[model samples]
Target: MTATKADRTPYLPQEPDLAAPLRLFCFHHAGGSASVFSGWQRALGDAVSVVPVQLPGRERRFDEPRIRHLPELVNALDAQLDPWLRQPFVTYGHSLGGLVSYALTRQRAAAGRSIPERLMVGAFPAPHRRHALVDADRLDDEEFARRLVDLGGISPTLRAYPDWLRAAASLARDDLALGLNHGIEAFEPLPCPVDVFTGDRDPLMRENDIDEWAQHTRASFSIQRVPGGHFFPWDSPALFLELLGSAIAHTGTRRASVA
Candidate 1:
């Protein structure tokens, strides 16, 4: 089940190890891309393959129009990621990514399709609660960009690039709509385990809201507070890698080899 040249797609920039013992399908925060996980392979060693899921309108997918709703993005991912789903894997998403990952899993469960071994969400609020920044959706382009930048949603260094302001704001606006426009929906809890974490200093993801993730999964649930702001994983790469690696070394399919 090893991937071939034909399996490569813009959605997944890196070659995948279908043969690996485990794979982690990562989704990036709004305004971010698969490049966020560029060093993850070396950081985690060969034990697990880190495959970042690049949503449209960012990175190489920049030419494509952005998807503004949650369901549409989930459906698109359902088809694009079918090949990688054949192997044992988990899903780790940050911020808006966490919401996308959760929606995708719920869709798979409803269809009796393959779901992740574990779902790990960082710096995100639980599904049912309206995200704290949902109101930001109403801001004008300029104000919107500034607000996101201040909240650490978009990097300040990107400001050097002339287009970063407008481009980042556009990407963030469309991506943010995935969660902002969608009302909460309830379903039978997922059959898989769910691990949740929040940045200790993040303004968007309150610690209390993180615990609500427990209601989304019927299996074992865990929550921890990591150091940093909304972008903790990048701000504290070593610590984040340590915590993430520990979560992967669980009594599950990660230990089981593919034939």
Candidate 2:
């Protein structure tokens, strides 16, 4: 059974059997929700079961306050995920979610808990790399809204509508706050392999930033260049599916034995 919000743990989505060889856990970027991975489940093929983790204060969990601390979120998730650790799994996170995935793995390692068999980070820099960043979260409401629109990820249609715009701005502020406050102390590569993917035109990540993920993973590391901008997965669903299928297949062959 999945854990509930009252349990003070991360809540896993309800799904089918757990015997699948490839169980992929997906985490969303800032200001996004589990809905982002809605179509991915079917596109990933029957062999691979896609489990998307829903962060608090978004989508159906709108009542829940947004989580600002990465470790706090990871700790809560770890508590719930430990039970499911009985089976092999892989983690796939995008942008902010990528950092969350890595942090979660580290937390598991520290507690001697079972960890994912592999990690897949997309459109995000390596954890150990220093970044010249800003504190958008500290800005006033008006300024925070301006920054969100400037970022260009939020849908223009939503920005046009006042209610949607207000909601989006709130989420953007919380997401930025989470990123700004979160810090990576050190790097300890997971026992599993790592894969990094990025859009050739993604302005957020430089070529070196993408390549440097290799240094953080003692397991095998691979990088791929997909088409489109930062949100390439949304831009090219078919291509993303192809790459995801390949990753799942590779995981089945290697499992957690890669070194």
Candidate 3:
């Protein structure tokens, strides 16, 4: 059966910019919406186009069913993003989104498709590393909420709204299951350069674990520690953006040097 036009729209909606030289596909953390990257275009200016990837069951896609498995999620994204792959693009994913970006890049490479110019991951460790935090999926609601709060995953606004909290918690559990339980048996290093960013104080991440990402990338690998906790991107948008801009700039410089 043919999918309808509504089904064809990319999960994240953005004004089309065919002329932009580079595209930065931004992926959000667990239970996060594209709104997490709202106003990034204005912040980034015209040198690069900022495109946020919206996962299902959140914000505008609230009606869609949530996907719990990493493979399933990235497969769906691969289909939606195939057309956009012709352009020079990079991916920036935070936490769970980082895994999604990395997995998607590998999936594309395995299929001999166009891969991103760069991969920027934040607040996530290498795929082979086991998560050190307690399993929130196994916790009772009260404990789950408290754990999320401790991880800075839950906000005060979410606490005030029972309906929102329930929905958010449900999505978060699905993501946590995928991130923590799923293990990759065999993996190949990616061809593109990788830049990893992590919060200095994020409890879920460790310097050694973050450094392990270097082994998964055959190209240049770099890691930077920014200030704040797990939600550092939200805590310090200016610093995060500065780091992001520098990464993008470095990619451009390298490409220019090679040319």
Candidate 4:
């Protein structure tokens, strides 16, 4: 039997209206939590309900063991998301979350299941072209933290809190391991539309790699660039929200035509 929403509550700490016509599932970057997308509901307003996916070993699920492998992580998420696929929804992921979103979509397609109306991938290259910018998983604690700081994933304020830094480093290592170790053996084009978001100054995602995402989807594909680094959504929420809102509108229109 499939699990109910309550049973899957741990995976999705922020619950939205199950009956909401349009659901926007947001996934966070490495070393991040659902809290990263907190308050997005208010930002996007009622037309779309924002539901943030909370991975294990972070935030409220801190006691749970972290998932270090891509396949394992995607399987766990697929199970939890199965029941929630009843309505029109979109997947919005940043960095590592983008990779997870794409993998999960492929998993669903492999099972002949419903896919997202739109796949919004932010700051992540297409799977086939994913090359590690930094091998955080192999780095020592201090070096890992330094890499995070350099990437804008760690802030100066976070550096003062040793305990928080250690915890973030641990989560980052596991997430980075999943990303670095996962290899793209084959390329399968998706049926759903894809929107790729990048930052003008993001050094990790090369322009050529971002453009290559077009080859992964037979459906409509587009790219938008904002004025920041890898963490542009955090630095420029207004611009990010504008782009997201436009994508949601486009998806909504598609849903109407299908109905």
Candidate 5:
């Protein structure tokens, strides 16, 4: 089927803020929707235009088939968001979304496009490392659903509806599959600042492995171990935003000095 503009785009509802000095493109976790970053603009203040990106198959894009390959999705994203990317922006991605953000950065860099001022990767391990969810294809349906539930990803209310739980689980399975099979053998270190955020009790990323991200960037690198589990961005939105704001501020300061 020929894809519509809506089908081709991954970005979701975000009020236009042309005057905002900075643009923040937020990528959600696997099985998560753009709604995850709803109202972030107000919380972050007028300085930023909070643009929440929705991967296909969730929320507003539910009818659009999900891209199960990382490179494919990254290419599409780079094409769709090319215009906005030329402006000053930052990115924050959680879990599977972190891989997307990172890959997208590389995609833009390869094409000589403008990249983000700062990249905030949260609740995910370094892209080069083989993490626990790498073998998602091996897990059976029941086992996978249980794992998603155990991770506190799906809502408790979804349990009341077994069909909803199953749907959520299936989406998560596909999302994980893409990340596991991202097929990135070469690591071209990024040019911009890369800040890593981990949940204190994250099941996906180990504290010791957090340092691995330092090798992915030539510019500034920092790590923040914040409260909550893998879903800390949702669990502690305020704390995450505070840290994010500070990281972006530091990036802006550095850019000013270089200019």
Candidate 6:
């Protein structure tokens, strides 16, 4: 299937066997682009193909308006992602993206399509476990910006530019709205397993919150704490790659069915 601007701009590095046993789709945090996963192709190598999901209003699609609600974004992705599901896909989502990943998995199951082979949640707490603390949508611009800085998810260069600052704020606001408004309607665990990754120094995610993710999945639940803060993937890619490899290695057997 042909790719589109509305759909995430996927980058494939050194084509792996197109029919490889496993494909990994990565969703970046808010104000982040698919480029975040560019290093992953090399890190993952031949065992798996890495495809990064690019949400609208960012990177190549800068002119598009940001989507502000969870359901709308999820629905948009559900349609765009349908043709891309080449079987036995696994999803890895960080921060705001984690919620989207979880919802997408549920939607896929509800639609009677092949469910992801595994779900990898990173940076964020389980949807149900997030504390009713700071709501980015409700925060003033200054407060919101501070929250982003505190989370250390946005880059310093982007934070310095006015245009990028506004764009980042808008994207952050919309994403926060989407994440906060996500619905939890009787979510059943996937038939496949799930792995959660969190940073030991991440101020936003507590260890217990990560542990709570176990309830959302009936499959074997595991959590690993990396060295860096919330943006561990950027700070320590080597360690991140190793952790990711371990997660993928644990799912060695060929999946029987995508569904």
Candidate 4 residue pairs in clash (backbone atoms < 3 Å): none
Runs in model 5 deviating more than 4 A are 1-10, 253-259
TM-score list, all predictions: 0.92, 0.88, 0.91, 0.93, 0.91, 0.87
Kindly list the per-residue Cα lDDT of model 6 for residues 135-191, writing each as its tens digit: 665777767776777777666676668687766777777766676646674577666
**Model 2 misses residue 36 by how many Å?**
0.4
Best by lDDT: 4
- Give the per-residue lDDT of model 1 (tens digit) for 1-259: 6456776677887767756788899999888888988888888878888999988887777888889888888898998887778778888999989999999888888887778888999988888888876787678887888888888877788777758688888888778888875766666788888999787889887656888888987888998678988888877888888888889888366422111
lDDT-better candidate, 1 vs 4? 4
TM-score of 2: 0.88
Model 4 residue runs over 4 Å out of place are 1-7, 253-259
The order by descending TM-score is 4, 1, 5, 3, 2, 6
Model 2: per-residue Cα lDDT over 106-224, one tens digit each? 77776676677788998888877643233564577666666556545677677568788878877866765556646675666677788998988876788788888887778789998
Over 1-259, each residue of candidate 5 has an lDDT whose tens digit, in order, gives 2223443344655534667788889989888888888767777888888888878898778898988888888888888876666568899998888999999998777777778889899888888887687686798877877787778888777778889888998998888877775766678788888899998988888865689899888888999988988888777889988888888777662321111
Score residue 69 of candidate 5 by CA lDDT.
Answer: 86
Work out how many backbone clashes candidate 2 has. 0
Error of 4 at 250 (Å): 0.4
lDDT of 3 by residue, 1-259 (tens): 3233344465657743667788899988886778889877887778888988888877778888888888888788899877776677888999988888988998888888778889999998887887654266668776776677788887867788888787677778776766855666488888889999999899889878899999888889999888998988878888988889889877762321111
Clashing pairs in 1: none
Structure candidate 2, residue pairs in collision: none
